[model samples]
Target: MEKILVVDDDLGIQKQLKWSFAGYEVIFAEDRASAIAQLRRFEPKVVTLDLGLPPDPANATEGMATLEEILELAPQTKVIVVTGNNDKKNALRAINLGAYDFYQKPIDSDTIQILVSRAMNLFNLEMENRHLAAVAPSMDKIIGQSESILAASRKAERIAQTDISTLLLGESGTGKEVFARSIHEHSLRKDKAFVAINCASIPENLLESELFGYEKGAFTGANKTTPGKIETAQNGTLFLDEIGDMPIGLQAKMLRFLQERVIERVGGRSEIPVDIRVICATHRDIPGMVAEQTFREDLYYRIGEISILIPPLRERNNDVVLLARTFLAQYNEEFKTKIKGFSEGAIKAMSQHKWPGNIRELQNKLKSAVIMAEGTHIQAEDLNLTFNNDALSIDTLNLREVREHAESRAIRNAYQIAERNMSRTAELLGVTRPTLYSLIDKYHMDDIKTG
Candidate 1:
């Protein structure tokens, strides 16, 4: 039989629950310490914790601490918090702290048993889903189980065997180059070189020569015949990062090369035939640029024959914690530190944070946290995130109302975090001061003192 750990100070309640849970082997603990001990020993799938424990039976301080410790040690365990009548506030707090669910006291054995049964079913379902996701084919470098990322990975896998020109679109730091390299590695040209160049980083005057090569004495500094990225990637793949930033003048030449599979070196008349696959990536709006006449429409169509949009980290649910744990292990080994895991506050703060910079931002934060963290577990403070227990309440089903609620909550949280400083709050929310003020007025939040 599966095990259930019951933590309560009252013998009557424990005895009643013991009788209530008939099919499961139940373990009892009257205090926080013994409860954790039982938890480590049995590794129960579910735990029912009372918010009133010994040495602080009247208050929930010890109970809250117990909840945090339990989650810290066994984050996958489904913890159901039991609270007194009129103690819904503490129950909600427990939920925010990662508890599975809560129950109010004057316990009905039948009702509590029903709740426990549901929790067990949900836990089993989650474990099965995790097992399935783990078994799914995944990219070696891409670490994510979210559908958005997995879909993108599947698309990449399907296209990896082909030599078609591909385009990857995503926000900066979303690892477009990583996908490009993965495709190259999976292709028939795996043994060949994979050359990468950033169009935006190279100067306009030098980019043409860099992509198409320069002949001997092509320019003042052209001392010898040197192959450019295109030639260097012969029989392999060329990753042109920030392709949207390629100048319109250069786009025509790139278009010619793509159409004919040949190129002319700088100051050289002979057209050089090249055999290479091209993968382009950018965070800019290429179609918009084409419309504005800053980029050629033909070049746009050529490079974007097959395009994939990679989702930002914010859109990936639960992947934040998963990726954080993976990075924590890596950083721990690299830094030679034994940092165990994230604190409950850190986990909550990470889930709530809007990761504007995507995976790169998370990686940077974890690296620093690993090196600088004081305790065994990394806290929200270590990651520079606020440990705000009050979460946004989603009480409505309307889409517009949900967006409005999110906007208002984000504005309020940023404003408070910024100490009512208008500029700082606007910066935090990634909006202008005028827009911030307009939102505050629209939300009837003029009561917020702005400095």
Candidate 2:
């Protein structure tokens, strides 16, 4: 049976609660010390804490202290503070200090039982969710179950054991570097250094020296001979992030290095051989850049020998929730806060938001929410996502408009789920090919491409 700890100094209230909670192994404690001892011994999931103890039965100091201590010991424990009928102030204070819920004196047997039952239910639900999250589907170091992510991961896995140049294509903040590291970690050179450099972050003037190193007195600031990123990863992998941002001048040098597996440092004469695998990532359309003459086609083809496209968070279906839960658990442990989970509205908002910034945005919002959230559960407001109102406004009550909106949404979703295959989309939507095309034209969704 589940244990319920009732901390009350009054004999009458203690006897009343014991009889009131006959279905459980009820434990009683008269003071803070006894209450903590009973809490440690029983480890009850639910506890009814009275604000009046022997040390200061008339005030709330001892009771408040006990509540803090209980939560500090076990943040998961649901402690319902019991205050006098007029002590709602202290009750609210206890809640801010992390008490699960609060109750008032002269408690009705039915009301108190309902409160305890609700807390127990929430506790069990959170525990189950935690266990489920622990075993959530993952690919190597990646956390996702969407077909888009899985497809990308499978491609990465297949080419990891090879030395082929890889290009990771994704939107900004879509964890491109993570894919790069995962590939290197799974490669033959896992034990060797995995160097990463952002082409966009480095200046055009210094980029060449950064990538190819420099000899002593190569420039005014070149104090000594130093190895470039490519040379440093002699037997390992070099991740050139935002490779599309690399200058046209540098592209030729980079191409030569890739072709010869050798480099000549700035102001140096001898060609230095460096056997390193190259992995490049960019959020830009390198093909478009090549067509526009802004990027070198030869370099693009060289680095993109094997390309993997990582889908944005918005298109990953329910993977957003999985990622959010993972981040919540991580931040919870990092901050030493026991946030049970996200509120229903928060989850709904997260699912609805487009997540334009992808995993990085979600991570930032979740970290801030974890630290700033006042309640046990993170709310929609904490994440800065608007909680959608279920109530239909007068403007949205028109049947024809609502039908059109729903149909458009359904068609788009079906088209995506069917991987943009017209016949498959029609079959999924239970519509003829002509009808699907008509709907797509009606919605003006011709630009929707499979990313």
Candidate 3:
């Protein structure tokens, strides 16, 4: 059961509070000294503090001191200060001093109880949100930790604090949307909407109206006045996905909106202002398109203030294995299966396969495999990878080859994950720095970039 600490000097009020709250386990203290003692002992999530303690029942001095001390002792506790009917000044002062809320009293059971309940609810909600923020992954929760992906992630994060117009350049299925959201999540506009519109998905005829609003009776289908995606994302983020595919005629209007933070409706003359951070993304070669005169050079310059290029799956060595395992675990829980992990042959096949569709393709394959897997462990055949036994069996049978292969891969993955901080990589590989350098030299991987 939840606990509430009531700190009031009046005996009658104490008894009234004890009887009023039936669901909560109410504890009482009559002075600041006793109240603080009960607070540390019980560590109650909520507190009702009356600013009418001994030596200052006529004034708010003693009670305000207590409130300040209570907050200093436990910053997380929600302390609600009760004051006299006309004591608005002291109530506001208590709030400034970090008290959760203030309530003026002739303490009715219904009204005071409701306020207390609301405070309790808010306290719980804030705690939960804090917990989620603590465990939430960086890079917009994208899973791979390879050097190429990490390099892009570092650049994205470094630029996330400002309101720069960010352009994400990557091949299809390389998680451009995920990185775009990382920028939003790390910015000043995190609390507001992260609105996204696919310029390629919507038809050219409808795309303009979708981005900018139209008045009532503007057209045959426009029976009611409608707000566009740009207006709806006020004081937030507007993600323009597949911007390379936007119509050439509409590019001039978009450029105007970026230059001046205002937009005109499809059939209206008045320019409505909007406050938003614009982030664009595309899988197409936008620069090449500009050279070809298919895409506007002016619009390209407007959105490309900070461009981050995400590497495709094949170039990110060992990331395919990492991403596959993450997808396997996710699907196992969703499908309610007990599939342990991938077999050696399955891992080899996935590592060598060209992931043309990238992360999206890998996820779909794993989702299908989890559903089709009949045994506790998924095999090579489950993912439709041909296990060339005659060719690969000799290598798998050699203990020295297996150990050396695993050791080399482990060292490489650790080095990348640590972003090539030599000390960190050494610690992760459970070796001295000199030992790690020796292994690197022995493996003939000195040409690989460590930065």
Q: Give per-residue CA lDDT, model 2, range 122-207, as digits (tens).
A: 68867875675576422357878789998898888888889999999999999999999998998899899999999999899999
Q: What's the CA error at residue 161 for candidate 3, in Å? A: 1.3
Scored by lDDT, the top model is 1
Cα RMSD (Å) between model 3 and the true structure? 22.0
State, as a TM-score between 0 and 1, how close model 1 is to the true structure.
0.62
Q: Could you give candidate 1's per-residue lDDT for residues 1-451 as a string of tens digits? A: 9899999999999999999999999999999999999999999999999999989999899999999999999998989898876676787688778887777767767557766886798788679867866775336677777999889989998888888889999999888998999888888898999999999999999999999999999889899998899999999999999998998889999999999999999989999999999999999988888889998988889988899999999999888998998899899889998776776557878988999999899999999989988765787888888756556445547654455557767887898899889999999999766556545533434345543
By TM-score, how accurate is candidate 2?
A: 0.61
**Best first by TM-score, ranked:** 1, 2, 3
Clashing pairs in 3: none
Q: Write the per-residue lDDT of candidate 3 for residues 32-57, one digit (tens) a residue.
A: 99999999999988999999888778
Give Cα-based local distance difference scores for all models: 0.85, 0.84, 0.82
lDDT of 1: 0.85
Distance from true position, residue 419, model 1, in Å?
24
- Between which residue pairs do clashes occur in model 2? none
Give all TM-scores, in the order shown.
0.62, 0.61, 0.58
- The per-residue C-alpha lDDT of model 1 at residue 297 equals 88
Model 1 CA lDDT for position 324: 96
